[model samples]
Target: MLQPRDELPSVLYSAAQVRDLDARLIAAGTAGFELMQRAAQAAWRALRRRWPQSTRVDVLAGSGNNAGDGYLLAALAQKAGWTVRVLAVGDPQRLAGDARLAFEAAQAAGVAVLPWAARTSLQGVLVDALLGTGLSGEVHSPYREAIEAINASRLPVLALDVPSGLCADSGRVLGCAVRAELTVTFIGLKLGLFSGDGPTLVGDLVFDDLRADPAILAGVPVKARRLTAAGLQALPPRQRDAHKGDFGRLLVIGGDSGTGGAALLAAQSALRCGAGLVSAATREVHVGAFLARCPELMVRGLASANQVLPLVEAADVLVVGPGLGQSAWGRSLLSVAASRSDKRQVWDADALNLLAAGVVQAPAGLVLTPHPGEAARLLGCSGAQVQADRPQAALSLAQKFAACVVLKGAGSLIATPEGELALCDHGHPAMAGAGLGDVLAGIIGALLAQGMSAQAAAHLAVWLHARAGERLGSQGRGIAASDLIAPVRELLEEHSPCLD
Candidate 1:
């Protein structure tokens, strides 16, 4: 049986892994049909609780175990006096094993079973069971048509155990995926639910263990983890006797000429994130603006990489590439920063592009923050490719550069050189503006300066950044890059307080 919860579980597994876990549970004495029945009961309870007033259900079932779950759910609804109809998209006669038993049960329960037609009129809540985590590649006919109908119906929908046509391993939509109002998943939480397109289409995710024994699941390693503030153990509070020198020195290099605002945003973010000392090496014209905007920053005008050497040598941590153009000046600054191996580095924006172009190399303690476009360049693939499997792209970047990688977008992911991944399901659509990446770079730099490992810094910075965006996203759009700074600072303090 699945337990009710306000939030999803932290651990995640691929579709194949979840299936294997199911088999393992069955092998461990839990009968396959018993698990299916439990899943149906759990999903039925969840559906009734969520849509209590709706006594009508339209279940779209296939011929697999996914369909079996749906058939059982329909049976439960029918027995409970709900007007339930099981629309068989695939031939019901082809159902075998537990799925066959489920169909028989639904029939015995007197649930209205009908073959789905392209022009089928839908009523009440929609149950999407056309496909499950077993699907990959493009969605084929009838199933595709069914998914389209479910999406186009404009009715509230509940998908059973991973939305039909959604790749459970990558979160990629197979041609098209069902957009459900709620998804009741069984056994293990699918990684796809928190990666790629999963979060957007999954709506509210509910998980049930199906009463799988803890010992049965003890040996399977998780595919990834969902990063949250509650899961992160923040830094210890600052000592009462702490001084300016107790923190860290952070240097930001960018602002080639016209885009000084990007570099400035990074510097401002670093200061706000608690860097003891923050400096900027940008165009001379931008120096006055930096001073006026943040007197705390040690601003220096620089034309070439040589000019930045002095400051780069002095900083404890370096944040490079915000507003850095592809021109020679921007290249020089990155080259100079890349030249040093002594300081930890956070690279973003043009820095990432330049790295992708092979202009500079990432150091040992490097943290690269690249959006889909930049990530595509690094992986030699398209933005769609990067997005289709964000976890793979992020992990590839980390492994390629031997650094921690933050692949930022809807579901931001942080991957380390060792292939460990943490995903942030936070953040808002309002973050689709400029200067945000620069701010994120600075935040990561600040965390690195504060003695956090590159991997830890990237995860913590992403969590804080996304959480801040989510809070501001509720207030409507027009969220500026700088608008995130104070909120992130506040979040950091709330989670990782300065006071003991």
Candidate 2:
């Protein structure tokens, strides 16, 4: 289950920004050591709550302030009469200032401080304080080995701040990061904790401001805003005298030979999400199937690019490229769709591919939904490169195309050309299926047609799609693309009811 949004701040920060926030607090008269003590206390309370019956804790310590936190936590456990040991992975002698003081306090409190070795026995619930947010380069030497050991232990682990070996800035694992089951982070929430490998490595997260002044925290710049169900901008309640034409017309353009289901899914999703009129333009062979499945959509079979011109002109919003194969038939339809600068469009799948290939240029008022591979192609980089810095990649795409870009993956990032960014971390692994992107494209299109701005539509659509998938995903895998539409519609009503 996802953590409650009320417990977390909406704003997300970079590692550097968090450090600045810490510095600001210290400058305001709160001692640095006091903040460290608060972090330890917060972590201890969370640990005890999670494992009330467990009494033993092994602290994996480094040489940084992160190690100090571990030492203080060890002291707390020792005073509580629980078996506690601090395995000093990073040489304890190198520790200085507050870290040294923390170590001395632990030793004075009768906490066992032992040098870490290859054959060190890892027992009970482990506390990972091996590395902090300052980590940049790939982890090397004993630290990597220690992180490996922690993962191998398979015991319930609690990571202080960011997980060891995980990039607090990018969420990329440096060599191998500690996979903690519970992570208690301090001060500002890091962006890496929500994107890339951060979500998978850092398990159930707990955030504490460490009692920093709210005005001080607000002064520092944030990387992005986290999109929560409660925080999303809702579509206004429909009028009692509303008619079908009250909402704008949305056209779904895609569905090549042997790939009709993709366009149908988008069209169906739009209809379910309250688009006034939804139309689908696909291959002639698939027209009958689309109409049979969803007769509400004005399904038209296209034979050439010219056939789509009229449909493109009529649509207030267009959803392009779902199962839109990289073929002549698909290319012709996308070309026509791209020509409509007046129409707000959600481009996904092969539409992104075509854009990357320079087959056509997308107009303004566009939402480009690209998975990592597609984003890589669009940016002329590898998929690994795109995943390494998802936030930057999303921003780059939005700026390059002057469009709203949804860099979809683990933590789907939504970026606007104006540099506004938002993240949706509400999806489940079970959402890994075909046609999900198509459904998302439709959802965005419907929201856009219903008078939401390009960025607002993309944000609301991504949140709704992911939340719907998360709900259905709980029933286990094998979720079809169509499975999300009803749930999305239901969730939309709950979020923005037809009647106030």
Question: Which candidate achieves the best lDDT against the true structure?
Answer: 2
Model 1, residue 31: distance off in Å is: 1.1
Candidate 1 per-residue C-alpha lDDT over 1-500 given as tens digits, one digit per residue, 9 for 90 to 100: 22433166788888888989999998888899999999999888888878888989999998899999999999999989999999999899999999999999999999989999999999999999888887867999989999999999999999999899899988999899999989999999988988888988988877889988888787788889998666786777899888767679999999987999999999999999888899999999899999998898999998677888889888999999998899999988888888888889998999989998998777775898999999999989999999989889999989998989999998899998898998888889999999999999999998888888888888899999998998999998999999999999999999898997
Backbone clash tally (model 2)? 0
lDDT of 1: 0.90
Worst 10 residues of 2 by lDDT: 1-10
lDDT of 2 by residue, 1-500 (tens): 33575458889999999999999999999998999999999999999988999999999999999999999999999999999999999999999988999999999999999999979989999999999897879998799899999999989999999999888877888878999999999999999999899999899999888989999998998789999777788999888999989889999988999999999999999999999999998999998899889888899988888888888888888899998899998888888888878778899999999999999988886899999999999999999999999999999999999999999989999999989889988888899989999999999999998999988888899999998998999999999999999999999999999898
* Pairs of residues at least 3 apart in sequence or in different chains that clash in candidate 1: 1-211
Error of 2 at 267 (Å): 0.3
Candidate 2's C-alpha runs over 4 A off are 1-6
For candidate 1, the per-residue lDDT at 128 reads: 90
Q: Residue 194 deviation, candidate 2, in Å? A: 1.1
